[model samples]
Target: MTWVGPSACTLPTVEQPLRVAEFDALFAGAVQGVAPPGPRN
Candidate 1:
């Protein structure tokens, strides 16, 4: 499924819900005390 060059390539949608447990563990382990990126003004 290559989006080859020529006309501007349309990127496919990645419509998967990420697994929360994996991200939760990673966030707790490596990202504690770090504020997430602030909302856009």
Candidate 2:
């Protein structure tokens, strides 16, 4: 599973859909100004 070189590594097609889902979750969280619970200004 290692590309291990000076070239690009390609992810499997099966994993492409999952990438979209991951991006969607991130986008939704950002739109809501979601942040890790911590000290704030």
Candidate 3:
């Protein structure tokens, strides 16, 4: 994946897929809903 800015991610490229899978599992188990962003105050 292409990272855009200067803040470098510590995760190595080889392990990125594992990290993505971990996030997918977490979201599948924990996320309850999806909503659009509300209007700015």
Candidate 4:
């Protein structure tokens, strides 16, 4: 969760919910190029 970006004054504010969700999914190890976790038998 280390957001290394420019200062608030340097960047414009905009809502990017999708991008956030995408990154969250990636960081949470849920959007990799492999089969997702399945239920146990």
Candidate 5:
């Protein structure tokens, strides 16, 4: 069986925990300055 979703966004080995505020900050930062690779073109 093959499946892909948000859960597949990362690898299974490393674990980088993030706080809600930290995540919100990162998301906001991305929107403000950093340009993500974004969806496939």
Candidate 6:
């Protein structure tokens, strides 16, 4: 259930939550949407 792959960011495990919080705060007002899964090629 990890949010990203090992190379996604340099933050250590303990610091990830803080980074997530920062993103959440910055994007709080962003538009929200979802798309249905597309068929596999």
Q: Quick one: ranking by lDDT, best first? A: 6, 3, 2, 4, 5, 1
Error of 6 at 34 (Å): 10
lDDT of 3 at 7: 47
What is the Cα-based TM-score of model 5?
Answer: 0.31
Q: Residue 6 lDDT in model 5?
A: 42
Q: Estimate each model's TM-score.
A: 0.34, 0.46, 0.59, 0.36, 0.31, 0.50
lDDT of 3: 0.73
What are the root-mean-square deviations of the candidates from the true structure over C-alphas?
11.1, 8.2, 4.3, 9.2, 9.2, 4.7
> Per-residue CA lDDT of candidate 3, range 1-41, in tens?
53333245568778776877887889899999999999999
Q: Against the unseen true structure, what C-alpha lDDT does each candidate score?
A: 0.49, 0.62, 0.73, 0.59, 0.53, 0.78
Instruction: Kindly give the stretch of ten consecutive residues in candidate 2 with the minimal lDDT sum.
Output: 1-10
Per-model clash counts, in order, read: 0, 0, 0, 0, 0, 0
True-vs-predicted CA distance for residue 36, candidate 4, Å? 29
Error of 4 at 37 (Å): 30
Candidate number achieving the greatest lDDT relative to the actual structure: 6
Model 5 clash pairs are none
- Runs of candidate 3 with Cα error greater than 4 angstroms are 1-8, 39-41
Worst 10 residues of 6 by lDDT: 25-34
**Candidate closer to the true structure by TM-score (higher is better), 1 or 3:** 3
In model 2, the Cα lDDT at residue 18 comes to 75
Estimate the overall C-alpha local distance difference test score of candidate 6. Answer: 0.78
Model 5 spans with C-alpha error above 4 angstroms? 1-18, 32-41
**Model 2 ranges off by over 4 Å:** 1-9, 32-41
